[model samples]
Target chain A: MKESFSQSMDWLHTWAGLLFGWLLFAIFFTGTLSVFDQEITRWMQPELHRVTPAPLDLDAASRTLNQLAPHADRWVITLPYDRKPVGAIGWQHDGLSTLKAIDSRTGTVIPRRETRGGDFFFRFHYQLLLDQPGIWIVGVSAMAMLAVLVTGIVIHHRIFKDFFTFRPSASFHRSWLDAHNVTGVLVFPFHVMITFTGLVIFWAIYMPAGIQTRYEGDMNAFWAEAELFFEREPANQPAPLVSLADLEREARNHWKDGQTRSIVVEHPGDRHALVHMYRRSDDRLSLDSGRVTFDGAGGALRAVWLNENPAYLTQSVLTGLHFVRFGGSPMRWLYFGMGLAASAMIATGLVLWVVKRQGRHAGADAVGYRLVEGLNVAAVAGLLVATATFFWANRLLLPDLEARDLWELRIFFAAWSLCLGHALLHEFLRDGASLKIWTTQLVLAALLFGLLPILNAFTTESHLFVTLPQGQWHLAAVDLTTLMGGLVLGWTAWRLHHPVRTSARSCHTQPVSSSSGSIGSS
Target chain B: MSLAAFLLSYGGLFALCLAMPKHYRAMCGANALPPRPVLLMTRIAGWLILGLSFVASVDAVGWAFGPVQWVGYLAMSGLVLVFGLPYSPRLVLLLGILAFLAVPLTIILI
Candidate 1:
């Protein structure tokens, strides 16, 4: 029998997705969470909880940079934005590199900050637990996913027909298939663009011939030219540097009316040293931005290269688009929504796999079945539990513990591995009460996320309720999210545990309950 | 320690799978064959190669070390050969080339 195009596509989509569903799920979940990365970073640092206007002393900050960076080859200063409490950002480089905040009025050192809240998750999302290679592996998986998407579209003849179809009460497989198709069709453009761009971002590793052949094997040389936005300047000879305040003034002139946001001193205190002040303005090259560079000793106006210029504007635009830096709150919300949809798509695809395979119970007790069952439990419930464990670890970890970053990462992977093992063992035992098992994890998630804020308040004085009204929203946002997530999970658990079938079954069998034991499959 | 532990767990799973009794032919479904043990040598080697590929990613991300520069590539190519004449060798080769070409070009452009 000849399969119709739509049928062919359905077949292609189902099998291809089922083949790598777990990987796709991980990528989508992590990528979606990456949308709120900054907020997470804000929440984790309990010490820097104030939201008040903490602008820095520019004069003193300038003086400090001048004094410390007598021979700094180059430097860039990033002014705090609306998210941070203070414009207290300061930078200086001599033999040492320091990023300190100043008392907006007094210019005192705010020192290096602690707390790895959202940033930890954001970074960990893309770059798995295993260091640099982990990121590449994740990237590879993402690329594979892009292939899956394209192939899926090619095979699906009735894309429009399935666009809005969602039948929740249908058979499990039918429901999962419908939900997956809906996510795939509605955000088709977003899914394609995101995956394509993601692959393009890592093209150099996947295809280096253009560089190796063109640059004649000098990767560094290629990078030197390629990384024009943040040019690496050679160190300069020792010499007195000029005023940073002056550079700021010079940079503002290019903007016509805007303000200065950063300062870069190249080869500070050397014969070849130059100082650059970046004006904060919206231009064609916002990513390739800011201005003002000058000879240090003589104070001659040099070329302005704060990530700007017509030739490299396209890359600047691409970078801006990739990072979503050009837009404000609305764009971030859009990205968040898209991310959630992407995750839902992957989850539905996995569910569809189980539903389809269940119909073919030709060898239900076979090795393949056992393996798939274990994977289903592990990837679905176990992954969530592992992720929750990460938050739990963060809460329990001692603040002053040495190598806390590594320890935090260790907890994530260790917990994940443990879950995978547990899933395999439980699946081997013919566990039929999946709903019961899943409900337990959801309840745990609800409790931990629900109590997180109260715990934060007890453990630290810088609680979000105190921080939010003042303008510091990071901590408040994290707490609010946790509490909300807890409520959602608690509800989900209740629903799963007290499912409609269970209620109906119990009512029907109530009269014979005393005689019958183990009414439902255990 | 991590490497050794991974090997042991993978090895044990391989062994356990192999020892599972294949249902008697009379009891088996008409089309179903008895479950055969997934060979220890094959699973162990496959996993080891996978681990190496993961390590190769380290070199790629860490130093952008010259392409095909990691020790894992040696194990990786060997492992890929294991299915020994996969039905679609040409396609796999093409994909491999594409992946190799794509990663570096993007890095340069980026």
Candidate 2:
């Protein structure tokens, strides 16, 4: 009975991993990149790369907004913080709202490139650029990931016996499987924590039955009650507003070291205007919990909202864990490393699925087999090519091009789709075990990433040579990481092109045939 | 302190690997497993050091972020061992010794 149970779990693990593995790879890869979204954004915008972080000047920002839109109703001031040292001001007038970057030291508006920046990777991580539908798709993929992880653990019979087992010099299938197991097992706790937290991040949207039943689907009213949100309608009587610095000081006093991330003035220049100061999430394990509301005209503290509900706080903490918003740089690097390992785990699993069938299913007539083979290449190597192209597009495209951000997105998708075509063509032209498709895509990615610093040197002043000497590690880190990534890719491509043969007879003691047989029989 | 925690976790994991017959044979160039008492000693030392790592992490950061950092440190140390054991067994063992030695050095220096 126990043997049968293990066999069934093996079948389930193989199928579920095969079905959603590609999507999960893309999700995990982009999510890994999203860990350093702010750094990437800094690297993309050359103008703000070296901005001296000065104290936020609210008065100058107010003057700029007043000059731009004297009759504006609402104004927002985004304070400068560590990762992004540029403040921004937006004002609404005549049904149009405009936002511009500002050097907080001078409070003068700066014209920066309008690329989507690292936010593209972040948004794509969860939404796949498909909005609501993409959320559902990613939700399903996360569920599949949970199931695959559980079943994988169950099928790994010698979990403790082979806890530190990894043989990179074994047969192709054996080595890939070992790589998959080592990465998955060594970081098993992180995988489980990250995946489970990811599921709960969108819990309200994914499982909204309670809210629908209790609150009749009135999300605003539900949030108002749950969050203890303070609100007031605009009093149209015109009145001069108090200094925002005073309100920020009051908020700091109340929270005792909490830094304000942004300030929003509702109905500015009115008697009933309200100013809301939100605390940054960088110092806490919960996102957007501490906020102070004030009377805009008098700078009187109206309300302080801190999350106190146990369930809500748990959800927030879980979300924070997945987002890695707290704990500074050491924690960020830890998450970045684990995130890459998770991506590698998924990529190796996908490759193992194809490699296990390589002996019997490497012909054009085996359409389904050939299809998976082609997709394995496209999903793994193709995504890297697309990511490299995205970075290159940031530097290659004209800074002032119309709809520049959308053009970057288009080029990214175009490169990915072209990679898929290349994979399919490469599959049709060969019969078995020819990895020219992988080699070609990886080589292209290597060039794009390895030469990014050179491209930056030609296009902007924030190249590695300049940034490294100036102590701009944020910009230099991107260039150096990409260069290292290029070297790894180039080495991988070389290995793929020049296949190494090692006999599986010397130390092959495990039951590799049993696992493959389960996949075949099922 | 996080570095100390990581080294402790690495040293602890290395001890656990040494307790296992396969890794011991591979890493120590031994044809047979050690005596029963030696294996038990190494296993106990592994768990004990790992527990100290948790304490060190909590002492450095507060209770809120400490355990989180501890988990990350453990995973990182395990990854280093997983790769290091197969590629460079001698270097991995040497690092494990240095990791254990650093604990007292840190306590005295800091």
Against the true structure, whose DockQ is highest?
2
DockQ of 2: 0.56
Q: Which ten residues in a row have the lowest lDDT in candidate 2 chain A?
A: A513-522
Residue range with the least summed lDDT across 10 consecutive positions in model 1 chain A: A507-516
TM-scores, all candidates, are 0.68, 0.92
- Model 2 bad stretches (over 4 Å): A1-4, A69-74, A91-98, A232-241, A267-272, A297-300, A362-365, A432-434, A499-522, B30-33
Please write out the lDDT profile of model 2 over residues B1-110, one tens digit for every residue: 77788889899999998888777776777466789899999999999999999999988887878888988888888889877776667777899999989988887787
Pairs clashing within candidate 2: none
Question: What are the candidates' individual DockQ scores?
Answer: 0.01, 0.56
Task: Find the candidate with the highest TM-score and give its number.
Answer: 2
Residue B25 of model 2 has an lDDT of 73
Task: Assess each prediction's global lDDT (C-alpha) against the native.
Answer: 0.55, 0.82
lDDT of 2 by residue, A148-247 (tens): 9999898876666788777665556776787799888878888898888998988778899888999998777777777767677777898877888778
